[model samples]
Target: MHDRDQDIIVCRCEDLTLADIRALIQKGYRTLDEIRRISRCGMGPCQGRTCRALVQRELQASGINIKDQVPGVFRPPTKPVTLGSIAEGAGRRSDHA
Candidate 1:
């Protein structure tokens, strides 16, 4: 593959390129879920919003119909709370009581 193809960004959040996707497809990865589990392609903060279609396209190009594959699942994004912050909030609530 050409260097230009390597520069085509498929998943910006994960820094994955089109070439990377193609390589995975060539390696017998036929489903979006398989690709996600192996490469964490659609498992980033955007949660497959950006790269799902791209990966599906690659799979289709490799002669795999996406309709037969298990769909990618996106989980709700969670913001991590620090233990100290939780403790502080609890202390404030107790003091008010």
Candidate 2:
């Protein structure tokens, strides 16, 4: 990558760049949760699967020891859910009502 083209996009899913993360860090958002909540960095479809490590690296570089920090919340059902199943469940719920 050329010097001018060296745009470090930490979160492609949320379009978060390195500059964005730095600004958040400068703003006293020390923890990943703070950054994630304010910038929606990890709330994309991939659920930070790709960006978590990058973000952690940035945090560590910023002098924040992330060794003890929880990487991020990962709920169950890691795989994607189908819309058809959602519709089926909704129908079942309505029937019970």
Candidate 3:
């Protein structure tokens, strides 16, 4: 079945729709923490590093005060690096610039 309503694709990895988030907001789900808990927007391969800012903007548009908005939970590493780079050992040092 085709989705009649086209919403913004927030999390490509998790396939979260903007409508889903808006509905949550309409349901009195304010703040990033509440939104994440209900809609799971940032729970994806890239995590919130991808769409946290956009989500915050949308939340602000709804008249929610987000000044003290803290970031969502973070998982391991914080950076996704290639295994080959680690194995190489001889990573690029200085002098290139």
List TM-score per model, in order: 0.76, 0.77, 0.67
Candidate 1 local lDDT, 2-84, one digit each (tens) = 78979999998789999999998888877898888899897777777879988888888889988887676556435446789
Worst 10 residues of 2 by lDDT: 1-10
Q: What is candidate 2's lDDT per residue for 1-97, written digit by digit as tens?
A: 2343248788888898888888888889988899999999988888888888888888898899999898778975586688899899999999999
Query: Which residue pairs come into collision in candidate 3?
Result: none
TM-score for candidate 1: 0.76
Ten contiguous residues minimizing lDDT sum, candidate 3: 88-97
The lDDT, on a scale of 0 to 1, for candidate 1 is 0.84
- Assess candidate 2 and give its lDDT: 0.84
Better of 1 and 3 by TM-score: 1
- Which portions of model 2 miss their true places by more than 4 Å? 1-6, 89-97
Ranking of all candidate structures by their lDDT, best first: 2, 1, 3
Count of steric clashes across candidates, in order: 0, 0, 0
lDDT of each: 0.84, 0.84, 0.73
